[model samples]
Target: MAELVLVTGGSGYVAGWCIAELLNRGYDVRTTVRGPGKEESLTQAVSTVADPAGRLTFAVADLLADDGWDAAVKGVDRVLHVASPLGITAGDPAAMIAAARDGTLRVLRAATAAGVKRVVMTSAANTASPSSYATEGTTDETLWTDPDDPTLIPYRRSKTLAERAAWDFMSGHEGPTELTTVLPGAVFGPILSTGTIGSVGIIGRMISGSMPGVPRIGLEIVDVRDIADIHLRAMTAPAAAGERFLATGEFTWMREMAHFLRDGLGPHGHKVSTRQIPDFAVRLTARFRDPSLREITPSLGRRNRHSTDKASRMLGWHPRPAKQTVLNCAQSLIAHGAV
Candidate 1:
């Protein structure tokens, strides 16, 4: 009999790929949805990459509530807790933090009680980064971002607090189940469907000419497919238990990303603006014109990057090049008519 793996947030971009990969690897997979309405779209999305073949199933659950979690973890061999609040752009910081932290705990408590072999959770690379991206140095999982730092954005703060809460919970845990976390950078790659693109919307904006100019910000771009691969590796690796692995890719600037799209997509890339937006202009726009740009002002001329040597050495993981990931993301957006 195949081991059954329960994946939370089956409708998510990363979670969808994780489901597809698990099914392809011959695992009997069960996933959670907030309601029945998402079941059809989630199945349709996962079907794009791998067939469920009667091995896939669904459970109704919500992170903010506890009614369905226990039943969701019944007889599960492993768990992948990949759902997090997507309030990175705008939301009440306190509300977002509460939801993310409490949601993680909800899943952990259920999985531990069920005696799942391992629970691999998805965290962000920024949770291990310096408060200021201008700090020049390569960081690893050993470093923990200070959640109280006022400079930290809601997304970073929420992720940091949530992961910290998970570790704190595990420290007191006495169970067979173990916890592992995969911290990915800016995740980008092919989309299974057009329903939810997540960060891949940045690529869509560039391809559709929505962005008039590029910022000086740089990102450690990792592919969505690679993100799913590392999750599976962490689920079964003995050394991965109770360890946090940084899964990041090459650091590339927005201007370079624009160039990659322009050069790689031919007619589709023609509208990509490679022009750099001045730091002052971006700051000014964030201050008055568009408040949504505020989240990016602090990232101008970012100098810090993360080291994935730990993931490579421990899990034998290697992410594809940033250029290829960028081009593939843009092409997918075009094909889906998302642009």
Candidate 2:
């Protein structure tokens, strides 16, 4: 009998790829959806890459609430908790923190009780980063972002808190089930469906000409496929338990990202902006024109980078090149008519 792995959030961008990779590798898979209607679409998305052939199943589970989790983890051998709070730019910080932190505990409590072999949760690379990106150096899993920093944004703070809470929970846990965490930076790459694009929205906006200029910020772009691969590696690897792996890919400035898109996608990338937006202009816009731009003002001229040495040395994981990942993401958005 094949090992059965439970991937939470079937409809998510990363989770969808996880499901496809799991099925491709001959693992009987089950994924969680918040409600009933998403199952059909989720199956359709995963089917584009690999045939489920009745090896895939679905369970209704929401992280914010406690219902449906116990039944969801039943009979599961391993779990990939890939779900996270979304659209966090303009919401109540308290609610987002609660959803992320409490929701993770909810999954952990249920998975521990069910005696699942291992639970690999998806966290962000930002969780292990310095509060200010002004420092120049490469950081790794040893560093921990301060969740209570007053300057931290809701999204960063939420991810850090959630990961911290999970570690804290496992410390007191005296059970057979183990825990591992994979922290990915700026997930990009091919999309299974356009329903949830996540960070790929910036590429969509750029390709659509909605964004007139690029910011000075840099991103450690990791392919979604590579993210899925690392998650699977972390799930079953004996050495991965109680460890955090940074899956941050090659670092590319936003200006360089624009050029990559423009050069790679000739006709399709015509609208992509190659001009860089000045820091003062971005700050001005954030202050008076659009408050949403405030979040990015801090990242202007970001100097910090994350090292993936831990993941490479431990799990033998390597991510695709930044240019390849960027081009693939842009082309996929164009193909899906998302631009």
- lDDT of predicted model 2: 0.91
User: lDDT tens digits, residues 145-212, model 1?
Assistant: 99988988898999999999999998999999999999999999999999858789999998889899
Tens-place lDDT digits, model 2, residues 1-339: 999999998889999999999999999999999889988888888898999989999999998889999999999999999988764324788888988999899999999999999999999999999977577799999999988788788889999999999999999999999999999999999888888687799998888889999989999999999999999999978999999999998889988999998888999888989998899999999999999988888889887899999899999999999999999999888888888
How does residue 13 of candidate 1 score in lDDT? 89
Give the Cα lDDT of each candidate: 0.92, 0.91
lDDT score for residue 25 of model 2: 96
Q: Mind sharing the TM-score for model 1? A: 0.98
Among all windows of ten consecutive residues in candidate 2, which has the lowest summed lDDT? 84-93
